[model samples]
Target: MSRAQNETYLLPFDNRIEINPALAGLNKNSSYQTGNQYHFVNSEQTYNLFYASWDSYSNKLKGGVALNFSQGMLSGQNISTSAIGFYYSGFPIKINNSRILLSAGTEVLAATKHWAVAFLNNVIPHDNDAPIEQGESFFRYYIFKPKFGFLWTNNSLQIGITSTVLHTRDVAFSLIEPTTTLGYTLYVSKKVDKRVRDLYSRPFEMSPELVVFYREEATIARLRLLAEYTDKTWGAFVQNDFTNHISTLGGTIGYRHNFMRFNLNAGMGIPGISDYNSFMCELSLNIIVPPFSHSKYNPWAPAKN
Candidate 1:
């Protein structure tokens, strides 16, 4: 069965803004809600995102690292937590005309016993590899989630594909290898080069998108749709827990200017088919350098100084 990265702490980061299409619209602010999977990572648009990765997010950086932070569907079950780990790229990278993305991640979940003993015999059960502190939950989970991506960027439109494992570390545990999530994630969205902005003004461009991901083995895995609409202000339209937890609607507001990306996401839990949930605002800034966009205005243009 597909497993989820119990790092519920990063739920907050999921509400933040992003450039990777796979993660862009699925947040708390938006009407889209997802299983307890970790969908957040460091700013990919930046030139130096290497520091905010798994082992590094907690070990090398030394600074605090967060993964997710969101309130669950149950009343009185408010959730706010973060972890030191890393996920994979939810987007594709283009080179000359080719695209490449490494779909993988590794981490040890600090889960309690209830979720641990269920599949205890199979996994290594700690003690080696990395030295974790004592008293810490042995629910340390690892994942080798693989992903597939497609990218096509010309002068008119930008589109792509991204998939994340529902849970890599699942089923039978191994004596040697680490574990990860099981299910898989797929993202199909398009960004058309609309009317020229006052220089890429938020009001001038339009990027509409759709999102869906699921896994049957993983009871928590479900399919959902998300669309990013922008005319003046960007709005992320979403549907959560469509597998069985229906009625949970979500949405987010976004705005972008040149090199800066901003976002605000809100999520609510559904009763009956869902759980009692409310809203939590999320904020984030992403710095991205277009792989093909030039910076000197015109590489061949003469200077006016």
Candidate 2:
């Protein structure tokens, strides 16, 4: 029997001059038999990421950078990987308030893996008793990957196309093939009420959104429908994703106080032919620093002059 677990998420809202940091962990285990011998393989990974982005008013131009570090351990062997990347996006042309934007990014990564060769030799019988000299304990490599994308947005509707890992160099220690293909997304959202008030004297609104994602590499598509209700101090949302004839339900709750906001989200996978018992949880915090000036043009300015 084998089991694997993974979790990933990207910030949903658009922000100018935003800074975000996150951490993730994964675990997988499997067992196999070679002839009369049986072996178990267990792997674990952890990642840390820091990202910062800035966008111009009306979202005409944007740029960002990200730094990532990851470590993986499999059967006592350890591998480490790190990357730094930058991206630029802009709406070079616009028509009647409808805009089209192009974005491109690249990342440079370095990886190293350390293996225990002598320990492996003891586990598996050798044909000859000849002494085995200790070879290189570790190997290092590098990779460069590029990404490009385009987006078109008008009012409440948006369409986007993106390509990732356009150029990827093979890593000798990698356990899985990198996904290097094109993907598409569609988003539509609508606000239910524009004139409700909350306890904090802030506008209360409810928005429902539908988003779809498709990947050419796997010929797989997923659809998500979400409804969010928010005020100045708190917000909540419920969403569901439909894929491969299965649906997953999830919800989020968030609170804002002073300059900081906190959010918590969780999801559970629904069962199909095989009983599924998978669930994920995530927590995030955001800090807002008001711009120095109120002019919409200067994001760093205070709103009131």
Candidate 3:
């Protein structure tokens, strides 16, 4: 069987490196994340994916750098793929006294695919386990590619675009698998809460996010509304495939304590070509390393009169 070419990242913001290289180190502090996803397409087909990513900002380099690795397997098929990538994003460039800024980045990825076949019970004759044909038992190959991305952001609005399949070994310029996102954040805080400025006081924030990806064979779009207050988060999303007319509904819950954040997400396919049994679940954890200055100052210090 051939490799599947169409896959989407469910949580775009949390899995930023997988979606856009330009998002490397875009968060307030350096972070590392690991996650696993299980997808049940049907009784016959199942998929498992695992990934880990880390990104850090460097003042000397004036940019952010990242490393990512992922593996995927198709259950019952004995097919697997492993990939590793390095990403970089420069510091944002200011736009003429406005709050807007633009950042550009790129990544290089190396991947290997392996496929093996297993004999059925009592199928192989004695001393004839080897393939009858030459070199038919297993297949393996390597792939190398480069991707580019750009992001524009202000205080409360963000837009990003990425080209995943830009260059390959055999082709000078292959199809540009494009992905884009638009986001807006709104803050709602009481008067008393706004007056009390402290390190631990965080405003209640709600964000509406939209993401669209277009491949050569398919188009996918997602609409999500998320809310965050201090250390808790919850969100819901509806995703649709324009080419295939498939839709799914999903929700996520998360908690943050100290330097770590944990999230659980689940999705179910709507009644369509397949029954309602199609489902997916993912669990992710993020560990952030705060900047050095985070612990240098004491907010409760007394003021001199």
Candidate 4:
């Protein structure tokens, strides 16, 4: 099965910047994040992907900037893909009580296809009538991708839309193959039991989010329900592919201490009439420098007294 270079199903929260450049400095403080995903497609096929990023809000620039790196490899394929991205977003425009921002970014990517020495030695005939001509055993190519997006935010609601061109060549010819995503976040609150409140320093909060990704080949959608208490978080999500009619189910647990937050996520393909076993797992970490010390620093501002 073919996978998108930026697919991060099980850990979307940790990889938001990869999905939308407008979110590069969306947080209130500078932050760092890194993660990896392991996809076990079947008994014989597997894929691994890794990424790291750092982003900071710049008061002087009145916006934010970010740097990110990611790589992916397949178990049986001799090909690997890697990319480095630089992103920026300008200051928000206030509308009533809400705010909105626009962002733009680009990435340089290198995709490599190579033949292993052992494979070349075993497969290439040396003495036969059909001796192959020896040439370079590897091919490497580079591509430039450009993207732009916007985000709108309020105390309880967030919506972002982003569009990216996969190839500079296509853009030059006006034949762009664009990938786009629409993401939403909603925060909810409920009265807490006094006993429950006493056990934790902060009140519990819940948010349900929905995100849709559109590509030339398919459209995928995910819905997630998340809860947080103090610095702990738990979440569950269901993802669906509209074109392929495939579904996945997953959950995540995370904790934050000091400047670091760690998370683990696991998911599996949902079987229909026929039983199937496809699994994906991911581990992620985030560090927010100069962690929020006051309520105003929260990503979602609280209502004033």
- Whose TM-score is greatest here? 4
Give the RMSD in angstroms, all C-alphas superposed, for model 3. 7.3
Superposed on all Cα atoms, the candidates' RMSDs to the truth, in angstroms, are 12.1, 11.6, 7.3, 7.0
Q: Which candidate, 1 or 3, has the higher TM-score?
A: 3
lDDT tens digits, residue span 1-305, model 4: 22333332223547777766676677557888899988776665566779998888886777889898988764544446688999998767999997888888888866554345335645767664332232233433456667787888776777888776654222212333543333332222223333454573446667777777776545677787777667898989886756445577889899978788898888888887213467777899998785344564674775453
lDDT of 1 by residue, 1-305 (tens): 12322333222323221112223221111212222222222122101011121111222422222232222221111112222333333344557854443323333322233333324433656664332222234333433333333345434344444444434342223433443334434334445444454545333444555434444422232122333344224454444544334343456565656645565555555445553342334555444432232347678655342
What global local distance difference test value does model 2 have? 0.39
Clashes of each: 43, 9, 0, 0
Error of 4 at 227 (Å): 1.1
lDDT of each: 0.35, 0.39, 0.60, 0.66
What residue runs in model 1 are displaced by over 4 Å at the alpha carbon?
Answer: 1-140, 144-181, 192-202, 216-232, 255-258, 269-281, 291-305
Off by over 4 Å in 4: 1-13, 43-45, 114-137, 168-202, 242-245, 273-276, 290-305
Query: Which tens-of-lDDT digit does each residue in 1-305 have in candidate 2?
Result: 00111111122321111111100000011111011101111123222222323222222233322233223322223444455555555534577976666666665665544345546545555654442232233444455656565666555555555555533333443654553444444444454544335533325545555544444322222233333334232333333333223244556566756655565555555567213334434455555444233456776765451
For candidate 4, the TM-score is 0.74
Q: Where is the poorest 10-residue window by lDDT in model 4? A: 184-193
Better of 1 and 4 by TM-score: 4
Candidate 3 stretches with Cα past 4 Å from truth are: 1-13, 96-139, 166-203, 242-244, 272-276, 294-305
